[model samples]
Target: MGQKVRWGIIGLGNIARNFVKDLALVNEAQIYAVASRDMGKAQAFSKEYQVPNAFGSYKELFDCKEVDVVYIATPHTLHSELTIMAMDNGKHVLCEKPMGVNRVEVQKMIAAAQRNKVFLMEALWSRFNPAIKKVKETVDSGEIGSLAYLHADFAFYALDRDFEGRVLNPKLAGGSLLDIGIYPIFLSYLLLGNPDQILSTSNFHANGAEIQTSIIFKYPKAQAILYSGFTSRSEMKAEISGEKGTIYIPGRWHEAQGFTIDRNNENEEIKLPTTGRGYYYEINEVHACLSQGKLESDLWSHQNSLDLITIMDTVRKQNGIVFPFEE
Candidate 1:
């Protein structure tokens, strides 16, 4: 552990670029290396980010002694393998969301991190957002009374994209649920914890990929309605209702810039903007955990990742959405 945390990025995709931009915002972090299957792409990304090292393969980046933690920004299907590999090579990991395609894979990734005695976290950036933090604080402070219900949705149009692309490809575990739906589901889980019963249904594309998913999480005293789809656009709003009043997170709630809290028939809007693309908060969490010599984040623990994936697994099973590559 040096004065600055050395970061190695395993993928140079759009998300990876955004993450690097936020990395620059963290004074204790630096992009030490980057890797891509294509040497040219790796070299170009390295040069663009002013990273000192670039590797043609992920293994090289994992083996780089200068690198401390590796950010796994590859596709959903590759997360488990790459994360375990990085941990095995004596490097910590901050894997991109969904952690893995299923609970089984998430279990393996967590085991690897524990065995290697290195920190590991799922990059669920929304959990680290200031708006989300405030929402939690308000709820816990009894400002909203007892929670009664919640509704959230995330939807977009992706039919125009290539069918073989990551959003539509079955091999990549592509689907609205795992790709974008997780946000709504996560919000429900964050506020209500795991549900007593989960009822779900999905609409599939011609290629057997799921395009839309609707879930109803039933709790003892509350319920959550969640929806995610790729066939059309949605308001992307989230609402939390309680006995006293309600909290409204406007469109794009997952990465929301602000939220409205209504109590006693009076609505007040609270704005909490991000420094970058809202990824800096999670990066800061990683730095804090590693600096404390902890192998898992208290906010987004390994068990938390496993629980989320298990919920998705149940939803997928109920909806009969199975990826082609799954055994």
Candidate 2:
């Protein structure tokens, strides 16, 4: 293979660990460095991943000349800052989903990448998943003919976790909307494009963080109903219904391994398993972009990130959800 894309992880959280595990599966990728606000945690993560360097501060990892890309797995509030920092330092970036708390931050991030002439992408990994890709292909093929409706839900019971933690902390931009709602919203946008009209409502925790959110995207020819929450566990299934048929993605649809299509009352399931937590697909996309000297992924382009964030901003506004951190 060509030169491995040296990866530097800026957060040592569980998501970061899972991402590194999948990174290991990519031949064109290597874990070069990791950082955490806590030096001990950084050291521990580095040792566990067999990385070459560890730092207590994110800047140290960002400055590593050997690091080609830095994956920002920090909280939603930190995504914009770290992405801009990494790109400003001449490193490419793959920031975790939501990309930013709102549209303004995402715009700044995209501009920074352009000004610095470095690669950048929002790590909406589900878009690259094998099953999701197949779903897209099936939809585009008109097998589900004349799409009429789409329904998706992503939720989990998180009330047991720390109320002041990221899941329910407004300071961190925590809420069902940014945390898990983006998946269903993304699926809608991916399949139907921007909605002509959007309707949204949210139920908030006592701490001002949203506990549950319901959104409806009205397209010229279709409608997508989406729900997300931390108040309870949902089946997490997604269904795409058309005039002639319907496709069902089983529970935990975001990481779905298979999907069933029902046409004229006949159901068929197609299995497409992913290797390792499904993060490897996006990692491979980053590898391909860097290898081709591209600054952004064509599959999940900057425009797509902008559009997604814009949709999110609208939903938050409609539901009266605003983070304290936004200026």
Candidate 3:
């Protein structure tokens, strides 16, 4: 831990803001540079975060010798392009989730990492969440018998957001399925692996942007019912139930601070507060992989990303949820 890993952040969006805040909590990491399309935004962000370097162009940041890794926080459509560029420049990458809009884009991103021999990972922070990890471990230990059912939903009334913003805009690969639906989908995949079959449908805005999605991942013995939307708000609770009992991730379960277990009329709640907004867990995961000279994370491997996107691709195809870019 003699030399801290220097991180360069692109896309000065809200997610990147929250991620930089969490990076401050980890001593092994540093925000060395920040870049935005607008020079004013880049300078302002670098000043606010006390970062040493600010680039108006992303490639200048990529070309920076001081940056050891780059965090791609751009729109979903830009993930593959920017990630491949950054990796080709000899920098590790931690791209935000929904790694790509579909499997083809994701496969190319994976190939970029392999070709460059650089560390790469999708920033699926929840996979490293202590409470969620503990719950998964508990479920695996047969504490809840066998997982037979799981219900998870993520939604926030985003209908009022900008019609052309990422959340509601079809051009940015926007929609609940790739934006928030991936949470519930990931929860199921984490606990149940891939599903035998996926049944799904969507409700779209007048402009053709998908606003709501209801999905059922069918397995041989277990089934996961998941949903995501911008039309209304959901409790965002997740219930992982088994033959013996259930585990409850209450209220905004994706970044859950704790979870509960109910079995035989008994209840137990375990709380594991995050350092910041919980992005640091995945940041540290990146650091760990870089330290070990590994190309991918074991917890959230390249295969895991492929499987996740492949599943979403199926749902999109099944329901005709095509982004403007894909067409």
Clashing pairs in 3: none
Per-residue lDDT over 201-317 for candidate 1, one digit per residue giving the tens place of the 0 to 100 score: 999999988999999999999999999999999999999999998999999999989899898989999999988999999999999998888999888898889889999999999
Taking all chains together, each candidate's TM-score versus the true structure is 0.99, 0.98, 0.99
Give lDDT tens digits, candidate 2, residues 90-161. 999999998988898999999999999999999999999999999999999998897899999999999889
**Could you give me the TM-score of model 3 versus the true structure?**
0.99
Candidate 2: minimum summed lDDT over ten consecutive residues — where?
A: 1-10
Model 1: per-residue Cα lDDT at residue 180: 98
Worst 10 residues of 1 by lDDT: 318-327
Report, for every candidate in turn, its global Cα lDDT versus the true structure: 0.94, 0.92, 0.93
Best first by lDDT, ranked: 1, 3, 2
Candidate 3, which segments miss by more than 4 Å at Cα? none
